[model samples]
Target: MYVPVSLLFFFIGTALFVYYKTQPGLLPETVTGDQVFPYFIVNGLPAGFTGLLIAAIFAAGMSTVSTSINSSATVVLTDFFNVTSHSEADEKRKMNILHATSVILGALGVGVGLAMMSVKSALDAWWSMAAIFSGGMLGLFFLGYIARGIKGSYAFVGVICGVLLIAWMSLSRQTVFHNYLTIVLGTLVIFTVGMLLAIAGSRLKKGN
Candidate 1:
């Protein structure tokens, strides 16, 4: 799946690049990344093909949304609910919670989609938002996976520090780092501080 998807994107990107290079006048001067595919379809493709492309795009979006909702529901059910509880009542309650979670997530997704309608550049906005949201999360995951001695307390501190750093970078008007580097910076800060704190605590414990 991954390989095929990667190759598909590669070919599509190559085609887009070649098209832009050969026919630079086709795109408007103020056009954005998000508008490229739609612009191409509207201007280049025949009416029948355009409809098909639009339908395919809609189907892909629906597929992604359904998959996300299902995954979210499953995670909420499995992680929060007591799977060991075999009673029918417990099962019903868990099922209720799962459905509720799915509904809430779907609503949130809709809200976000509406909000993004106001954004000028969807691609940039998405990348920036993803970085902000996943920065601390991915940091903690990497720290836990790579570092052997990091305890929960150290991890907690690291998460706090990472969140604070990302917040500062995001909110500061004079920030020097590019938007794309935000996640990388946050992950590094968390892992480095978490590991150092863990090592220090270990040494202090041995000395004591």
Candidate 2:
């Protein structure tokens, strides 16, 4: 558990940051942490850890851009076009919607990167934010797909709790390595709320 968690920080954490930098308006500023920290503190290394970090960052940024573009394309084709299901709109309308969505997603990504400037530590901020944002998606999967007849309301509530707790932690200045608190808090909220919603949704379904 400990090793895996540590790896997540060293790997996933670094990757997320690199992704952020790749976005427009979020490029690196002066000689900050990334520039200051040597690959190996004790001894210099060639083609070393800094190289690895740079590679990881590019991979992350490229991956995000690729996936977001793909998802947007799929959504336009399937949802707006109703391609396989049905094509309600004409080609022009569908094309317009796809373009609009692409612009929106790009704008939103820039906004998120800008917002991240206020975060105290890069790793801590990323982990905590990821936990808070992803909990609801995870809850939706558990409630809608994995569990039978789970209520959407319960999932919403769980997400709310997760946000509140994370926000409180953010304000309180509680710092722990590996961001264990955020993960534990987020998972607990998601699991509890999902279970409750599943129970309630089941009861409601049975009653009606």
Best by TM-score: 1
**Candidate 2, position 113, lDDT:** 81
- TM-score each candidate: 0.78, 0.53
TM-score of structure candidate 1 = 0.78
The clash numbers for all candidates, in the given order, read 0, 0
Candidate 2 per-residue lDDT over residues 48-105, each given as its tens digit: 7657767887898889796987697768777655856453777887777777777888
What TM-score quantifies how close candidate 2 is to the native fold?
0.53
Candidate 2 clash pair list: none
Residue 56 lDDT (model 1): 93
Cα lDDT tens digits for candidate 1, 3-64: 89979966886788789879898888776666776788898899999999999999999999
Estimate the overall C-alpha local distance difference test score of candidate 1.
0.83
